[model samples]
Target: MEYISFYNGNEMPIVGLGTFRVENNDECKASVKHAIESGFTHIDTAMIYENEDKVGEGIAEGLAATGLKRSDLFITSKLWLADYGRENVAEAYETSLKKLGLDYLDLYLMHWPGTDEAVMIDTWQGMEDLYKENKVKNIGVSNFNVEHLEALLAQVSIKPVINQVEFHPYLLQASLNRYLDVQNIHMESWSPLMNAQILEDETVKAIAKEVGKSPAQVIIRWNIEHGVVVIPKSVTPSRIEENLEVFDFSLTAEQIERLDKLNENSRIGPDPVEYSGH
Candidate 1:
């Protein structure tokens, strides 16, 4: 698997399995287990996903099935909004760790940027403390825009290693990506396929046809080629295996530009600026 090396010398898989709406415990467990068994070394989930117990089961089973050590995998979980208070952060993280049945997480992220600046800063402080104490290997935030990133950066000591956001062919956020590049913060893609919406896009279909790959593969590869880490979620066994098969082929410069120009700045999740919380 291809990896993006961070500034601190750690590495993350370019492709990972995202667990967002996999609410059903059994299915979530099976999907994660299947993913690991199919050679996936990276797994992304959050406390709000509400299926950490099952994800833990899958991880246990997957490791046992593949004889892979815990250190061989990169596991990430997030701190939810309700758990944003300075004192609440550790308890929330421990709860997730308990449910995930893991001793520690490879990466931890603030799930969103609420409107409260102080709360956000406090939450980040907790994350930084965790990182400094070696409770987590890395810390980041999801759905944070430039303004929020600036606010958090000004208040925190260790800068967030990554900022994950909704990105796909339809919503490129080129300017934000450039800003992330300048700030030395890695930009990771959450809904890289736009909930499979990009899979049916005409340009994506054409490119897939030209490359003899599925539209999903084409879009996923496009995200990776853009230097964005992508986590394409799938519960289906075939698609889980298919999503990871993007390492062999390469998208041409022209094809990459074609996909790049498809961005309309659309979003499927809440805008960071306006979203207060759930």
Candidate 2:
């Protein structure tokens, strides 16, 4: 698996399994197991997903099935909005650890920027505490815009290593990407396939035909070529295996540009700024 090194020198697989709405415990566990058995070493889950327990089960089974140890895997989870506070964030981290049946996480993130700036800053402080205590290897924020990042960076001592967000050909987020680049923050793409919407796009289809790859593979290759970590979710065994097969061929610069022009600032998930769910 290809890896991206964080600012602190920690590295993770460029591709991972995203567990967003895989809510059924049995299904979630089986999907994770299948992904691991198919050569996935990275797994992404969040407290809000409410599937950590099952994800943990899949990790245990996958380790046993593959004879791989826990240290060989890169596991990540997030702190939900409801857990935003100096004290509650740490507790939330512990709760995720317990649920995932792990001693420490490879990376942990604030799920969102919250409703205002003070809450985000306070929550970031809590994340900093986790980093200092060695509870997690790296810390970051998800769904943060440039404004939120600037405000957090102005107040915090340590910079976030990543800013996970919804990204795809449809939602290019070019300006945000540029800002993240200047800040030395890596971007991780969730919904990289636009929840299957991009698979049927004419441009994507033509590229897939030209490259002799699936449209999904073309989109994933685009993210990797642009230096973004991508986690595409799937529960089917065949698709779980297929998603990891983008290393063979690459998109040419011309092809990449065509894919780039497909951007319309579209989003398949909720907008972070307006989302008020706890």
Candidate 3:
């Protein structure tokens, strides 16, 4: 497995399993178990996913099935909007940790940048506290744009190690990607596959045929080659295994340029600026 070393010197698997809509306990548990059993070392979940307990169950079962210790895996969860305040953020982390049956998280992120900048600043303080207290190994933000990142960086003592966003061939986010690169912040892709839309694209399909790989593999390899961490979610055991098989092949510079040109600035998820949930 490939790893991305954070600014703080912590390394996480470049590829991970994302649990977003895996709503039910039984399915979530089984999916996580299957992922680990299929050789996945990193798992991503969130407080909003409402399956932390089941995810915890899956982690327990996966560890038991694979004989892997807690330290052998990298687990991540996010703080929901409702838990944005300084008082509530740490509590939210504790609740997620308790639900996941773990004492410390490998990484914890602010799910979104709330509308109010001051509130987000306080939220960062809470996350910083968690890091100081040894409750989380690293802290980051998801769905944040350039303005949000600048605000946070200007006031905070610790810089976020990552800025996970809705990145794919369709929504390239080139400007944000460049900003993050300059800041030395890693970019993580939440919907790296664009919910299967990219699989049907003519260009992607043509590239897949040329490379003798699946469309999913081609897209995933593109993200990896761009130095972006990708978490492609799948409940199907075969796909969970297949998503990890992207390490074998390499995409040529021309092919990568072709894929890069497919960007249209489209988004499958909510826009961070207008999204004001709490």
Candidate 4:
């Protein structure tokens, strides 16, 4: 698996397993376990997902199956929008820790900017405190645009190391990438396959055929090659393995350019800036 070294001194796997709508307990646990067994060390979860306990259970099962220690994995979780605020941030972090049954998280992110301004700043400060306390290795924001990032950077003592956004071939954010690159903030992509939209594109399909790889694999490979971290969710065991099978081949510049033409500025997930009114 490819990796991105965040500015905050942590390395995140380029490809992780996203657990957004994976609601079933047994299936989520089994899929997470299968993903870990399939060479996925990065497991992304959220407090709002209401599956941290199951995610923890799956991780334990995977560790038992593989005999790997906690240090061998990079786990990430997000604080929900409703839980944003200084005091609640601490409470949320503790709650997530209790649910995950872990001493520390590899990374913790703000699920959204949240509604309350004081609460947002408070939560950010709390996250900074958590970082200083070494409760979390790194802190970040999700669904944040350039303006939102700039605003946070202006106020907070600790800058977010990464920004997880809804990036994919169909929703290419060149401007966002350029800005984040200038700030040395790494970008993580959610809904990486563009909700399987790229799979239906003629150019992507042709390229996938030429490369002897599936369309999903090609899109993921493209994202990694472009230095964007991605998390593709799947409950099927076979697809989980397939998602991890992207490291074998490299996308050529010409192929990447061809795929770049597929961008229509389509976003498969919520827009962070508008959603949070930031």
Error of 3 at 168 (Å): 0.3
Off by over 4 Å in 2: none
What lDDT is reached at residue 169 by model 1? 80
Task: Provide the global lDDT of candidate 3 against the true structure.
Answer: 0.93
Error of 3 at 76 (Å): 0.5
> lDDT of all predictions, in order shown?
0.91, 0.93, 0.93, 0.87
Higher-TM-score candidate of 1 and 4? 1
Please provide, for model 2 over 201-261, each residue's C-alpha lDDT reduced to its tens digit, 9 standing for 90 to 100.
Answer: 9999999999999999999999999999999999999999999999999999999999999
Total clashing pairs in model 2: 0
- The sequence of per-residue lDDT tens digits that candidate 4 reaches over residues 173-235 is 999999999999999988887777668988989999999999999988998988998899888
Estimate candidate 1's alpha-carbon lDDT, on a 0 to 1 scale: 0.91
Per-residue CA lDDT of model 1 for 186-269, tens digit only, reads 999988888887788889999999999999999889988988999999999999999999999999999999998987888898
Q: Ten residues in a row with the worst lDDT in model 1?
A: 269-278
- Candidate 2 displacement at residue 79 in angstroms: 0.6
Off by over 4 Å in 4: 115-118, 276-278
Error of 2 at 100 (Å): 0.6
The per-prediction CA RMSD against the true structure, in angstroms, equals 0.8, 0.9, 0.9, 1.7
- Give candidate 2's TM-score: 0.98
TM-score of each: 0.98, 0.98, 0.98, 0.96
Candidate 3 local lDDT, residue 247? 89
Model 4 RMSD vs true structure: 1.7
Q: Number of backbone collisions per candidate, in order?
A: 0, 0, 0, 1
